[model samples]
Target chain A: MSETLQYIGLGIMSVLNGPELFSIFGIGVPVAIVMLMGGLLTGIAVGATPGLAGPMAMAISLPLLISAFGFTPDALLPVFAFLIGIMKGATLGGAVPAILFNLPGTPDAMMTTLDGHPMAQNGQPKRALRIAQLSSVSGDTFSDIVLFVCAPFLAVIVERYLDLPEKTALLILSISFIAAVMGASVGKGLLSVSLGLIAAFIASGSDLSPRLTMGIPALREGFSLTAAVLGVLIVGEILSTLEELWRNKHALKVKDVENRGAIDGLQRGDIRRIVPYIGRGAVVGTMIGALPGVGSTLAATLSYTLARRRHRAITASEDPQFGTGVPEGIAATEAANSAVSGANLIPVLSLGIPGNAAAVFLILAADSIGGFNPGPAVFTFTENEINPQLVTAFGIFTLMALGNLLNWTVGGSFMRAMGVLAKIPAHYLLPVVLLVAMTAIYFQETSMFAIWTTLGFGVFGFFMRKMQVPVLPFVIAYILAGPIERSAREAFSASGADPWFLFKSPISVAFLVLSLAAPVFLSRGGKKPS
Target chain B: MRRINQNMALGAVIVALALFALFAWVPNDTVSGFVESKRGRLSIGDAMAPGIAFGLMALSGLILLLEARKGDMPGALEQRTFAFLLVALTACAVSFGVMIWAGPLAVAVFGGEGDTYRNLRDTAPWKHIGFVLGGTGLVTTLIALVEKRVTSNAVMIGLAAALALVGVFDLAFDNLLLPPNGDQ
Candidate 1:
């Protein structure tokens, strides 16, 4: 249609208007492009390492970016561009370690090791790496396009139809789904959510009444979201690492993995063989990503499992199996995991609820840099004024595409450079990271008490991880609690004091039912051992 | 089994939270026995946190109790893992131990105008944040090195790294506030 063409032309123009859109050091530099490249490079390095993942990188980088950019609308695009770059780059970078060293840098890469490592052992490391790159880039591109199409539609529908009570129910449903799928058990997940809600409750500001801060002056100001997240996710992780180091103090053997094996480009036939599996992975990954919290590991596992089953059904059972370095195995995993990078934003942009830890960090970064509020109103169209938020979202999509393009070109070298990245000893890294996290918090809050809060939360987060309670649900709950509270209050008031008002609407009723049932059924069906 | 201990720990935690919701904390600081949120007048939103917290805590506690009846809730978290966690925690705690006394002592000795918290601020005259941070780094490194029974060289490096961290934060980010002299 002409409308589609017109939109495409506009998109092209905006992308080309990069120099005008972005500036750094008062120079007309393409800031989004630079952020995308820098974030991608950082992501690739972090992901290729055995211990670090994309979210960890993003969490550490967030405070630095905030300090640099300050709290401004212009900061959002560059920050997100870098983050999206990391999300995309990490997916591909994870495959490097899994294939070359048989060490999965992240959980999703666990599956990649099955086919990829075997391929490395069988002297097809380059071929396997190439397949992973192509499949990953393909899957990410496919999912980004889906996100570009679907997030707006989903948000528009919610804006048009959903009211306050329905919105509350929808958030409940999201919480239920996230809690159901995240931790070891639904009970544990719910407990984490409750704790998060409690934290939010403690922090909630009141008009006439005193908040539930329990009388301490520091408590009155409440907990900072950045400090909490940095403490819990980044600093807690550092403590955990330190614990590991102390326990393994005598076991400091530097793993000297020979960075041999020249990576060869994928042939047309290799690409042809992988195309179908990549397509399947994209579809599987997209479905999982759009949901609240079943993350990329599940997507990769399911996609690879299905591909294996389908391949077995089609071909002779004895002929080249998935475990035997088949291209399809790599394709399925890489593509599926990669698809999650973009599609994970769906629930985030549409509902303003972060489904997973990575999404939580993204939302935290967005909160730090204001002017873009995620929710149904974000998708609202007005005839008079331009929807800058929606425009920013579109701009983010363009950056993600550029990230994929970067991965395609520089990703091979990234795999080779993994040795240097992974070699940075944890003892050195942890100390510096701890300092940085504390400093960022101190600068932002201008109070050393905030730093203490960060440390306390870090300890608490470590315990939460150790206890097997999922941290993601807790954080998401904490983040969404204020908004949900407002919605619930508004909905209650609007219902003329009807106690059972949430169940009055069919949509609300359906969502409420789904929220209740999801935990029971989904938790029962969970793969984690009891 | 260790998972059994974890279950009990979780149960204990839930019980503690539930009690807090029901009795200890509420929206209002004003009322007696059964009051929820305290208000100057009457407000509808006062009961939201307390009421929600109570209900949700009860439900979660009940569910956790039910799970405790069944056997192993896996994914590590045992007394053995708790030992290592304690070690890391102690190191971190030792590092921050100075922070607790630094502000109060600084005020006592140097005589700051504001409260204890203010004396600890980046701008506080009495506070020497750099030395405090360096001291923390020293304690952390000392703890780790003594535990490992490493040579003096390792101790020196740890001390160097601690001071380096203080220096790096100072130079790289000028406006960044540390314990006191920590920024310098």
Candidate 2:
């Protein structure tokens, strides 16, 4: 515990004494803090705009950040700080569009539009925004606190208990669970996972000769990770959105509302009324977020349902109900979704499994930046020497805390002013986004091959989405393939090439059994996690 | 009915691909077998992971096929999808062609007798030419295709975006180079 505290202190000091951005009165401001601020503002802008989200911004920024700060240990803190700030800021900013224009900027904000739009209609737009900001910050802070306490302990426990075979089994179980829970059916999900594994294995990283390059010279080098991922996630989304827009010729226009005796601020009574909803939202959001592949859309939905039930029971017949411009509805949804941003990191930090797209980007950033990697080893403490990864982990936690602090102080007003961003048509933005994404990929890989690969993957992704196949399982499987193979090989060698290595140990057997059973037990049809 | 047919077709395609991969592709493409013994130490080989993956795909494909017969419908692609893809890909190809060949063509036409695009690729005017032209064309073409009209506003926006990207990526960062230029 003392060692942990010492490491935390060291982590805080590292950020404090990080590469100076500027000096203020004989004191230096670290680049990490400034980047955090910049990322938060950008995240707000992106999230406020309909059809733009945190992951897309992070995807576009990752390569740029890498270019600015090379693959060095010193770059990790600032880059991570920026990404985390974006995650937190976007969580708050997603509520803006929902409240002002009745459009959910991000899918999780769908619940927000239920009450937020009505509140805007009732001339309590400012009140709704205030409620959203307060509850979001409160829930976000609660989840961060839980993460601060939980992630390190969980990592330590996982490190102590899991071995090579068990770890390999665990990765399989994670993939299976994700496949089962995501997409239309267990079969389709598994197919997506298989395709991802094939993509990852096409050019073998470990072997002297490439495995499945299929006689293509470029395949020997394998596809670039950033290109493939962004191709599917961002470029694919762009293509799909553009197709819809073109087919329907529908351009969305936001209608302005006249302020009718607008009440802006929340009272003491209002605060007291919403606190319970916020607490419930925080707890529910955290629990769901800790489970890989379950996202904040479910969290907000569940929390809003719970809040509605309780509110219905207590309120008089004449009182404003949950969805009829009530502050409580906004509070419940905003809190739950925002809480998810912090708690999503729990799985990533503890077990090296990403729970959502935002978490995936964070993991990608860590992987690209090269010095730090997330997993149980990240929390490992030694008696003799300092663990740099542990310090980086603490630095990430510090950034989260600072982000929550900024959200509490200024995020509300910034969000309220972002109503105009929601007015920008999505159709106009997507093509530009595609061009930028291609440019970003090209600049990083410095090859036209990467651009072509990205375009090819983009078309594939579009088809997959249209066919109702989930893309998340495939992406997660691709990321985990290398680690899974490494663990399997090590376990096989360690156990003298025992064919049934995964089933030999009780824990490994249990995990393998669970992997098989996951599809049967956990399959949820065709629901996209936001 | 259309959705069900789509699912069935998809399932069949998946099964065929998986079978080909397992039987023909894996064997032909991979130099190593599923397992190899090197110097009396047995180890898993390159084909093991892909073999298992393809096997999984096969199982999934069979399941999907059966499920489709049982009246499960996921979704179907519309004819508009192919049309959209055709147009989009055509635009991308033409724009990229201009991007790749524009600089060299310009150099051949207008440069000093012995000067080549390679020599001038990093220099001003030459470096910015391909990116600005290709990027603007791409963006403008996409917007025009979607909005169903070619507007000057779309062209200006695309041009501005291309120029701004150049300013930020090329001028601001000394290490970073724009596309095709980077390839050059």
Highest DockQ, which number? 2
Per-residue alpha-carbon lDDT of candidate 2 for residues A1-530, written as tens digits (9 for 90 to 100): 79989999988888888989998998899999999999998888888888788888988888888889989999999989888888988898999888888888888899999999898888888888889999999999999999999999899888888899999999999998888877777778888889988898988746788888878898888878888788888888888888888887554456676688876667669899999999999999988888888779989999999999999999998998987889899999988998888888888998898878888889898999888889889998976999999999999998999999899887878888888998887777877888888888887788998999999999988988898788887788888888889899999999999998888889989999999998877654433341
DockQ score, prediction 1: 0.31
lDDT of 1 by residue, B1-184 (tens): 7676667667777877787756656635423222223444322455565567566766777777677667667555656567766665565566666654555565666664655545355553444444455444644463453256555554555566556655665556766655533332
User: Each model's interface RMSD (Å)?
Assistant: 4.1, 1.4
Off by over 4 Å in 2: A524-530
Cα TM-score per model = 0.87, 0.98
Residue B171 of model 1 has an lDDT of: 51
RMSD of 2: 1.5
Q: What residue runs in model 1 are displaced by over 4 Å at the alpha carbon?
A: A1-28, A249-268, A526-530, B27-43, B75-77, B97-175, B178-184
Clash number for every model? 8, 0
Give residue A84's lDDT in candidate 2 (0 to 100).
Answer: 85
TM-score of chain B of each: 0.56, 0.97
What is the model-wide C-alpha lDDT for candidate 1?
A: 0.73
Could you tell me the lDDT of residue A512 within candidate 2? 94
